[model samples]
Target: MKIAELGADGTEQAYDAMRQLRPHLTSAGFVRLVNEVQRPQGYRLVASWDALSGRVVAAAGFRVQHMLAHGPVLQVDDLSTIPAARGQGHASRLLAWLEREARFLGCAQLHLTAGTHRYDAHRLYLRHGFAIRSFQLSRQL
Candidate 1:
């Protein structure tokens, strides 16, 4: 397996992967969002692909954003491994790649949110040196 940063040509693959995980996003909306993130001055989308089969097995995306407490932090918005490709260390490898990238970008810390029901993912994050920092609160508009 090889980890590659999704470039201009890799947008379609990244969109497909995200749509598979999040079916609610329409293709048009997803495309627009991808373009926004792929902008030269914005966030990055990194994916791990299987070299032999040419399939994207896992992905982790982050952006350097400012916060009151941390100043500049790497906010990981998405981390996903294809269902069929889980338990193969793809997620772990992608996370390792993200950590390196975060450090290289001079981020003060890495931050993310996991769903309350995703116990397995929570455990994985804990194993990776991420602690339960705080509860996420939100209200629908």
Candidate 2:
């Protein structure tokens, strides 16, 4: 498997893998969100592709930014692997790739949030050296 960032030319191809994590997003919306709304804000997309199938098995969306509390941080907004491709190291490869990106960008920290019910993902995060620092609470308007 190969892990790499998906440039504008490759953004559209990330939809399928990403949709596994964000099922509510339409392909067009994902593209627009990445290229228009998010890209302008420093967000980038990366994916893990299976060399044999030449198919994207896992995808991650992240950005490098400075938060008052964390200083320089690489925040991952989405991480997903197609259901059929889970437990095969695709997610781990993507996480490792993201960590390389974080260091290359001079980030002091890496951040991401998993839902309370995401037990498997929580394990993955812990294995990758992430700690559960705080609870995230959200209120929909």
Candidate 3:
């Protein structure tokens, strides 16, 4: 599997894997988010592709931000893999890649949030040395 940052030309290729995580997002909306919303904040789309089939099997959307609490850290906004691609280490590979990127960029830590019910995701994070820091709360306007 090849893990790399995707450019505008590869946005379309990332849609399917992204959709596995964001089921409500339309392809167009995702493209716009990547180009407009995320790009402005220096967000990046990283993906793992199936070498033989040339398909994106997993994807991680992330950005580096300076927060009052954490200072500069690589914050992963979304991370998911196609169902068929699970257990193949794609997500782990993406995490490893992101860790390297965060270190290279001088980030103090790598961060991400996962839903409480996502046991598998939580397990993966725990295995990767990520601990439950604090509860993440959100409200809709």
Candidate 4:
């Protein structure tokens, strides 16, 4: 397995990977979002690929920004391990890599949100040393 920063050439693969986990995000939307992130700006997308199979097994991304209270922070936006690739430590590897990258970027903290119903993911996050910082309230626009 190899972990790499996704470039423009990997947009289609990344979109397919995200769509496999999140079908609600349309292909066009995923492509557009990816293109926007690929710009020389604040966001980054990382992918874990199985070199032998040429398959993307896991992915995670983060947006770097400054917060008044937190100084520099990294907002972890998406973290997904392909259903068939779970239990293979792909998610953990991706997360560890992300953490290292965040540290390299001089981020003081990392934040993310998960649905309340995603208990398994919650457990994984806890195991990875993430605490429940606060509840997120959202009203559909």
Top-scoring candidate (lDDT): 3
- lDDT (tens digit, per residue) of candidate 2 on 18-130: 99888899999989888999998999999899878999888999998898998999999999998988999999988899888889989999999898988999999999999
Identify the superior model by lDDT, candidate 3 or candidate 4: 3
Candidate 2 to native Cα RMSD, angstroms: 0.9
Off by over 4 Å in 1: 37-41
lDDT of 3 by residue, 1-141 (tens): 899999877877888988988999999999988898778889889999998888999999999999998789999999999999899999999999999999999999999999888999999999999989789999999
User: Clashing pairs in model 2?
Assistant: none
Model 2 ranges with Cα > 4 A deviation: none
Listed in order, each prediction's TM-score against the native is: 0.89, 0.96, 0.96, 0.89
Candidate 3 ranges beyond 4 A from true positions = none
lDDT of 4 by residue, 8-31 (tens): 667666665577557898877787
RMSD of each: 1.9, 0.9, 0.9, 1.8
- Candidate 4 regions off by >4 Å? 37-41
lDDT of every model, 2 decimals? 0.78, 0.91, 0.92, 0.79
The better candidate by TM-score, 1 or 3, is 3
Q: Sort all candidates by lDDT, best to worst.
A: 3, 2, 4, 1
